[model samples]
Target chain A: MSFLSINSIAHIISAIIGTGAATAEEILYFKDIRDGKIDEAEARHLRITYKIMHWSLIILVLTGFGILAGVRIKYGGTKTFYSPVLWAKYTIVLVLLANAVLIAARKMPMKWAGSLSLTSWYAAFALGRITEKTREIKWLADFLSKFNFVELYLITMVCYILAVAIVAIILNYLKKIIIKKQ
Target chain B: MSVLLQFSLISHIFLGLLGIILFYAVLMVLFKPIDFKRIKFLRRVSLLGLISFLSSWILGGYYYVVYYGNIVKPLIKKSAYPWAHSIFMEAKEHIFLFLPFAALVAVLIFYILGEELEQKQAIKKTVIILSSLIVILGAIMALTGIIISGAARLR
Candidate 1:
């Protein structure tokens, strides 16, 4: 395969790993906290998933940039590099990186961070998969392309904030359910 | 584009990326308590990040002066969204100058202060802010470059 193809495969693999890790982390978090506290096993499981998330992120960035460099070499900066959807995805990745920093600093609330982490990862994953060429979403292509970079960014962030709120509510509800069961 | 121009363009991007990654490393290191043992290592990384930014500045400046102004500039200007050049590139080039200067100051703070920085909470905070500033500015420059390039291609 060509250099681009190899990098593309690596990028997709990393994305899958990242998305899966993020999902597992959330699910495990809820399960581990069912008793209102974390045991050693729960802590270990959470740590392992976090490590997976971090590793997958590093791989995703390396492969993603490699793919960009390859595209730049062959095609210069085409729409593929700067489309609204792509830019939205790029900003979401930035948010993810920034969120990780906040997490490391122990600055953000765990609830907010957890919600942001889960939502941003899924948003980035969904944006990567859906494109203008997909026959089912062909109309989405024409529809989304109308918005500029700033609009898409605002839309993504608004949606992101809303998702965080919604997820937080669900988590709280789940916590009550668990507490009542106990 | 000629082979030389392509090389310059790619090198410029690679260096910019290197600079961003290094500062990110610096921030990650600083996110924890200041390690007296890692002070020297911290300075080294900060210095390298500064050099990367300055080097990228020179390389990107060469690309802009030699080829971009004469050819790519006009193509982008005449494109459907001339604002990509008129605004994004215009603002980006000016704003990019801030990055190397900030990185240099950050390097100097770490180098000259050494472990002394650990004692001064305010100074440590400033250094962290500077590193964060560099990362944010670098991301903006990269994204703006993408916009400018896309405009040139479509036109």
Candidate 2:
């Protein structure tokens, strides 16, 4: 197996584990709230979810940069930063990461989980479509093609990160709504 | 394109759209308080999700044979995307296969078992397993695409 394979497989496993842990925590938390056993539920699940999301974000960034670094060495690539798609992706990821931190701090709005999830998924889907289009266009033998697949992938990942942040905001909002109603 | 490939592409796009819709519906249920009415909505959404998920993969398989198997498969050894490497490509293949199985498990758990947080231990476990699988599988698929594209640059 190449070093790329080793790194990718490790990243894949971590992503799966992180998502699984977060999902489990959310399900259990929701169940506890639904059963009016909120107090009975361990408070640790929220912390665990926070930790999972944080570490996953770290892994995602690290792997992304690692891939870029590896490519730089192999291709004798010049560093250029004039990619719109990459910029878009970076902005989205940064915003999303900030939201996740807020969620971990219990400072985000919870009432919007439904909307947040919907929007997040929509953003992710759009990002995927755009990523595909970018690749197709970038590979076009045009003299000044700007939409490379790697850039597109970066944008897509950033979109996903943003979506995650939206979820965190929505979760916070939902919690508030439920609390107020009670 | 061959008939199989054409069918596969259409099916894949259709299923992807349907899955996205169902994903939103599921989110609504999770975020909002569940009432009887919401449960009914959930049932409808889950069933629809199952159909679309199945269709997407059936088409995806066809696409795999036509596009990857015949054309890109042979050329990959020589191709390299900017961030791509050969091993990354192989791992992508593994993820593409495994993620679908994980999705299948999630669909079965959520739709077939009709167990979405009834609060019983078994039901809870089933729902957890289903949701967790979906989340994890989705993440894996996304990551695989990124790495594979990156690795392709090496060729």
| Cand. 2: chain B TM-score | 0.63
**Model 2, position A132: C-alpha lDDT score:** 40
Clashing pairs in model 1, backbone N/Cα/C closer than 3 A: none
Off by over 4 Å in 2: A1-182, B1-7, B82-85, B96-116, B121-129, B146-155
Q: Which ten residues in a row have the lowest lDDT in candidate 1 chain A?
A: A130-139
For every candidate, C-alpha RMSD to the true structure in Å: 3.0, 14.5
For candidate 2, the per-residue lDDT at B127 reads 54
Kindly list the per-residue Cα lDDT of model 2 for residues A92-171, writing each as its tens digit.
43454435534433555655433343343245334424544655685532522554746655755666667666777777
Cα lDDT tens digits for candidate 1, A1-182: 86568878998898899889999998898787778889998999998998888777767766776677667667766767666667778878888889887888789788688878888888888877874254367678777778887797688778867987898788778877986786
Q: In model 1, state the lDDT of residue A103.
A: 84
lDDT of 2 at A33: 69
Cα lDDT of model 1 by residue, B1-155, tens digit: 77787778777877887898788878878877777777877889988988989898988999999988998888878767699889999999899999999998988888788888888989998888888999999988887877787777632
lDDT of each: 0.82, 0.51
